[model samples]
Target: MDVVQQRFAEWVYKLGITLTERQAEQFETYFRLLVEWNEKMNLTGITEREPVYEKHFYDSLTIAEAVDFNKTSSIADIGSGAGFPSLPLKIAFPHLKVTIVDALAKRIRFLDEVIAALGLDNVTALHGRAEEVARDAIHRDHYDVVTARAVARLSVLNEFCLPFTKSGGVFIAMKGTDVEEELRDSGYSAHVLKGEAREVLKLKLPLEQSERHLVIIDKKGSTPKAYPRKAGTPLKSPLVDPAASQ
Candidate 1:
């Protein structure tokens, strides 16, 4: 095994996660492809091998520790730039049906090519905006888990993710240290979307000592249809202070 692959394997082992030999090979292939494609497409800025293993691979695996995978059969990764958590999670748990949605066609193309190259049968890449895709009957309220990694603001991200999550499902947002403040700002929209902050899982990765928060928002009921307004409306006019509006 290469240095990157070996370190990744050790990290997973230390975290009490096991990947079959085949799965490890798949991840190795993905790592190589990401490094190569990034040279041309600027898919990611973290080019160092060790950083890729920890930030991209291990960071993605943190999702497995936070949620019950058996309860979650279907998931959508919104604005999946470079397929951070989705691709890595799919490789880790192949049974989970995963879809990666990105507005940029180039990123979508990269995801598709990587999936095909890895012979990953459990993932799909869609090139479109989240709001447009979520509005469709086939996609609306379909996924058990809707995830976003470093996407929009908390309020805007909630609008983008909540509409697609099934009742009783959860929207897991992978965020940085500002999670508490974002939650405070997004309280009204949380109520509007029938979501409540369920839990926050703090991550610890190798080499870097930064806070990664898994903000879990449970979809208790159906979101109001008016939600996820046009492309920029959520950011511009979010549901701030639900009681005042009522």
Candidate 2:
């Protein structure tokens, strides 16, 4: 393995994740594909080799620190723009079954190309808003774990992601440091969506030292059919703690 690849493997190795030579090659191929397609579309601003490895690739793999992939069967990534945690997790744990949901068709095409180039299996890239797609029985409450990056606030994420989480499953939200206020604001939504706040796993990027938090919310029951409201509703009208307004 080259220096960049070796460093990445070592970082995850500390997390108890073992990467074989093939997986390392797949990650390298993914990096090349990401930089290549990024020229045509606005895939990601963080395209440099090492930075991509630290921020996107390693950051995605950190989910393993919170939940064990060996025990988890399926994961649905909601609003997986450019396929963050799900794609990398699938690469590391070949046994995982991954479903990536994103609203943009162009990004979906890019993800499809990456999956093909990587020669990955059991991965599906769907183009649609998370709200509508989670309503489908095939996807709704079907995954063992649901993931979303800091794409939206906690309350909004709860609405968009909880529907895709099966009962007794967990929705893991990857967020930055400003989580205290978000947790306070998200109480009602979590309760309403049949989700309970669990724990947050804190860690830092190997090189950058930027703090990242994994907000783990346990799904107690199936999402109410009324949840997710509409494709654009959650973001515009995020649920807030009633007491805060009072």
Candidate 3:
């Protein structure tokens, strides 16, 4: 095993998870593809080898804890730039039906190439904005789980993710330590997404002192059709708080 693969394996094992050889190879291939493609595209800034392992690979793998793979079959990574948790999670759980959505055609092109190179059968990369795709009957309310990483403010992120989540599905946002403040600021936009903050899981990464928060929101009911409200409106006119309404 190469140094990178060995280190990744140790990290996953320490996280109370195990990866088969096939899974590890998938990650290795993904890392190679990311690095190769990044040379030409602005896929990610963390190009150094170690940083790629920690920030890209490990950071993406952290979502495994928040998600129940047994119950989850379909997942959509909204705004999945360079295929973070979606591709990694799919590697870990090969049965997962994963779709990565990115608005930028370039990023989607990169993702498609990576998917093809990896021979990943269960994943699809879609090129379109989340707001537009989430409204389509095929995408709207179809996923078992939706994930986003540093996509937007909690309020805006909710709008982008929730529309694609099934009523019982969950949207897991990989966030930094400021999740509490973001959630507080989200307010009515949270309600508009038909979701509520379910729980926050604090995580520790190897050699990283900074904290990370996985904000899990459960989609409790149907989001009102009027929601997401065009491109710029959710951030501008969030729903009225029910408590404030009272």
Candidate 4:
């Protein structure tokens, strides 16, 4: 194994994830594609071998720090810029059926190429706004785990993600250091949407040791019909904690 593979393998091993040779090769191909397509359009800023390995590959797999893909099957990644945790998790755990939703057509095209190149089965990349897609009978409330990584604040993310999460499933918001403040603002929104903040998983990245928090919310009941109002409404006017703001 090379230096990059060695580092990634060691880090995932600690999380009870073992990478196969083919899986490692797929990840390498993914990196190559990311770099290649990145030249044409913006995919990611961190494109170096080590940073991509640590920030994108390893950081994506950090969802394992919260819930094991070994047990979960269906996963939806919202606003997956270059297919983070979901794609990496799919590589590590081939059993997962992944659905990635992103707004940009270019990103969807890139993701489609990546899926075809890697020969990854049971994975799909959809091009549309999260709010609109969540209303589709085919996708609405149908995931075992729905995830958004650094997509938006918890309040907005709750609206974007919780609508597509099946009742009793989980929506994991992967955040940075501003988790406490985000959580405080999100409690009311979560309840309004019939979700409950279940747990917060705090961990650090391997080399840089950057702070990461996975806010796990359980879908206790179906989201209200009014949620995710429109394509841009969530971002324009995010749900707020009436008490906190007052």
In order, how many clashes per candidate?
Answer: 0, 0, 0, 0
Deviating ranges (above 4 Å) for candidate 1: 14-16, 242-246
What are the lDDT figures for the candidates, one per model? 0.85, 0.92, 0.83, 0.91
Kindly report which residue pairs in candidate 2 clash with one another: none
lDDT for each residue of candidate 2 in 20-84, tens digit (9 for 90 to 100): 99999999999999999999999889998999999999999999998988999899998898889
Candidate 1 — which pairs collide?
none
Q: Which is superior by TM-score, 1 or 3?
A: 1
Give the TM-scores of the predictions, in the order they appear: 0.94, 0.98, 0.93, 0.97
Question: Candidate 3: minimum summed lDDT over ten consecutive residues — where?
Answer: 232-241
- Candidate 3 residue-wise lDDT at 50: 73
Of models 1 and 2, which has the larger lDDT?
2
Better of 3 and 4 by lDDT: 4
Poorly placed runs, candidate 2 (over 4 Å)? none
Deviation in Å, model 3, residue 65 alpha carbon? 1.2
Q: Give the TM-score of candidate 3.
A: 0.93
Q: Where in model 4 is the C-alpha error above 4 Å?
A: 243-246
TM-score pick, better of 3 and 4? 4
lDDT of 1 by residue, 1-246 (tens): 777777788888765578888888888788899999998888888987778888888998888777777667999999999997888888877788998889999998899989999888878899998878888887788889899999877888889999889898899999977578788888778888889988888876776888888899999898788877887677678768856566
Ranking by TM-score: 2, 4, 1, 3
